[model samples]
Structure formats: structure tokens, C-alpha cells
Target: MRIAELGRRTGVPVPTIKYYLREGLLPPGERTSPNQARYGEEHVRRLRLVRAMVDVGGLSIAAVGEVFAALADQDQEERGLVRALSTVEVAVTPVPEHEDAEAAAQARAFLERQGWRSDEDEPALRALVGVLGTAREVGHDRFWELLDGYARLCGPLAEADLDYATDGPGGWLEREEALERVVVGTVLGDAALAAVRRLARKQAARRRFGNPRADCGTEGSAEGGSEGPAADGATAERP
Candidate 1:
């Protein structure tokens, strides 16, 4: 594929893509000819991932770069992943969305029940309530049930994050850097959560109910059967 095609697929402008290339944010494309650079499937995949991180995941360029590096490092550890995931910031931006009466009622009820103060952006709370409101509107009861379990798991987790983020590395975080961290953390953290969710499901089945598929003599399945590299390539190194 050509650079034009990459831009088209990624919805990024050609000049911006070139800027990324120049900034070393993106790897150099193969030279099809002296004046023409040809991209391939790898470039396409990477560009899409970058766009998703910036546009949807709300990552800053520096943070996005760090995340891309950590993702490809293969030599990274859990702490490295934590560093990458902590690069994005969550701000209290009013979305300017008009909430329907019922949706408002549902969200209010959900938040009230969860005891989450809406005084801040509250990414975790917003995500949970949004999932519930959307689910109820779509005629599903399982979303609330899922939220119940997830909330029980996440409440303490949030406290842990607060403890660590404030006392650990993120404590030194500057304001401008917060956005970058917010972006990186939001994307990597989501990936981390996905890794955990996958493990949790397997654990609920294998050990919670005692399936024989897992190796015996342990309290639970190893790494809870996490994906690809187990929990992450971060947790276990490849020899």
C-alpha cells in the first residue's frame, strides 16, 4: 500500500503521517522508488492502533510513543506496562450530551447505589454507569449483574491505584504530563484490564468450579490463563 492509502485507511492526513514518520513516531516506510515510500500491512495495523490510541483512547503524542514502544519492547516487565498505562490523564470534561430522563434516572440510581461521588471526571464510575444505562436501554439485565461483580472488584482496586499513583511514580506527575499519561494509561490500562478479564473468566470456570484443564496443586490456574504471553508479555519474559 502507498502512503495515501495509509492515510485513507487511518483517517489521518498524508502530511501528518509524514510528520509522524519524521518525528520517529512511525517507522520508516519501505522505499518503493527514490521518491515513493510504500507501506505494508504492518504499517496499516500500527497506524490504526496509533489512531485508536489518540482519538478514542485520548493519548498524547509522547505518551502514545511510549505506549507503542512498551507494546513492542517484548523485554518489558509489569512495571514497564504500568508506566506505559499510566501515561494518560482523565479530566473532568463535560461531554455536553443530553441525557434522556430515563437514562438520567438510571445513571443517577446506579451511581448512588455504587456510592461514587460524581464531583470529578471519575472514569471508572462513568464507565460503569454508562454501561448500565446502555444495557438497560437495550433490554439487558446482565449488565447490572456484571457491574455488581466488577464494582466489588474495582472499588478496592481504585483505592490501590490511588495509594500507588500518589505515593509511587505517578506522584511526580506534572500537569502537562498528566494528559500524556491519561492517554497511555487509558489504552494500556484497558489492554491490561482485558488481560485480567480473560483470566478472571477462566479462573471462575477452572478453579472456582475446579476444571481439570488447569495444572493441579496450585491455588489457581497459572496466570489465570491470560492471553498471548500470560497476563502480558510484561509479566513473563520469553526465552
Candidate 2:
């Protein structure tokens, strides 16, 4: 296929496809002529993966490049996918700064209690320490009480995640395709998990607090759809 056909098939514009090739996100096609190149199914697949990472996964071009670089560094015979995934995680997560000794100790203790053998240089451990420090700063030290419960919840989630990444359709896939699956799953999975958590939280809140909106709707209907000052003020105060 030509570049135009590749772009048409992937629903990506030719210029954007050209940009990806220039950025090394997509491999160069075979040169059929001076100004024409022939692309194959591999190019189509790579373009789709690149689009998913950029559009849905919200990875910046540089971050995507770094992830690709990490995956490329893996040994062909013994692919270090975990290391590649770690690189992807690091790219998505912000680097921690301003170490808090007390919070770091707390994070370390929590990890020890959870039996998680995290390295000292791990981004997540550092992020946890930062979170603990911020929680204390905001007078929410009580949040520490939920750490164990959160860890327990995440254990099953991690298992499910690994199962999803490793178990492909028909139980077989090329290494590049497997890596693509992992990248798509990890990046988009975080977003999906967060959205589901928010939905769950909302449901829990409704059950616990008894749907304030239900009463508000009734009151508004009784008042001929004229929300009173208190309702107006509350609405204004939101967001």
C-alpha cells in the first residue's frame, strides 16, 4: 500500500503519518520511487498503535519515544517486558521531588507490611512518600488508615492486569504485538480504572448520604422550577 492508502486505512492524515515517520514513531516504508514509498500491514499496525498511545493513552510524543526506546532495548531472546512497562509507568507518572524523610519512612514501613519488594529508586514508592507528606501537610494524616485497605484492593487489580496483558487472543502473539498490547492496556487501563473508581465513589456517596439531588428536584418542581437562593448559591458554589 501507498502512504495515502495507509493513512486512509488508519484514519490518520498523510501529513500526520509523515510526521510520525520523521519522529521515528513509524518505520520508513520501502522506497518504490524517488517520492513514493510502499507501506505494508506492519506500518498500518504501528500507525494504529501510535495513534492509540497519543490520542487515548494521553502520552506525549517524547514519552512515547522513550517507551519505544525502552522496549527496543530488550533482548530478543529474553524480552524484559517488566522493565519496559516500568519505563512506560515512569513516563506517565510525574517525578517526585523534595524528599520527606518521615513520609519516606512511613512509605517504606507500609511497603514492608505489604511485603512489596520495591526498589529505593522506584517512581511509585517516591510518589507514595510524596502523597503521605502532602496528606500530613493538609492535616489528613488519618488517610494513612486506609493504606492497607487500598493495598489489598490493588493486589487483585494487579493480578487481573497481568492476566489481561499476558493472555492474548488465541493465546499467541508476536513480540511487537504483545508489547503493543501491554502499552495500550497499561496506559488506557489506568484511565479506565480511575473512571470506574469515581463512578463507584459516586454510588457509595449516594447510598450513604441519600441523594441530595432527589430532594432538590422535588423542591424545584414544587416551586415552579424556580430554585431558591440557597439552591442557587449551592449550584454556584460547585466546581
Best TM-score among the predictions, by candidate number: 2
Regions more than 4 Å wrong, model 2 = 76-79, 168-172, 214-239
Full-model lDDT for every candidate: 0.59, 0.80
Q: Residue 184: error of model 1 in Å?
A: 3.6
Against the hidden true structure, what lDDT does model 1 obtain?
A: 0.59
lDDT of 1 at 157: 67
Q: Tell me the TM-score of model 2.
A: 0.81
* Predicted candidate 1 versus true structure: per-residue lDDT over 1-239, tens digit per residue: 89999999878899989987876678899898999988987677667667777676556677666655644453334454444443233331223233345544566666678886674235444544566666777988555555556679877766655444334644645432433344444565666777888988877876576544334444334544543444344433525
Give one digit per residue, the lDDT tens place, for model 2 in 84-128.
778888987765778888888889889889888998888888888
Q: What TM-score would every model get versus the actual structure?
A: 0.44, 0.81
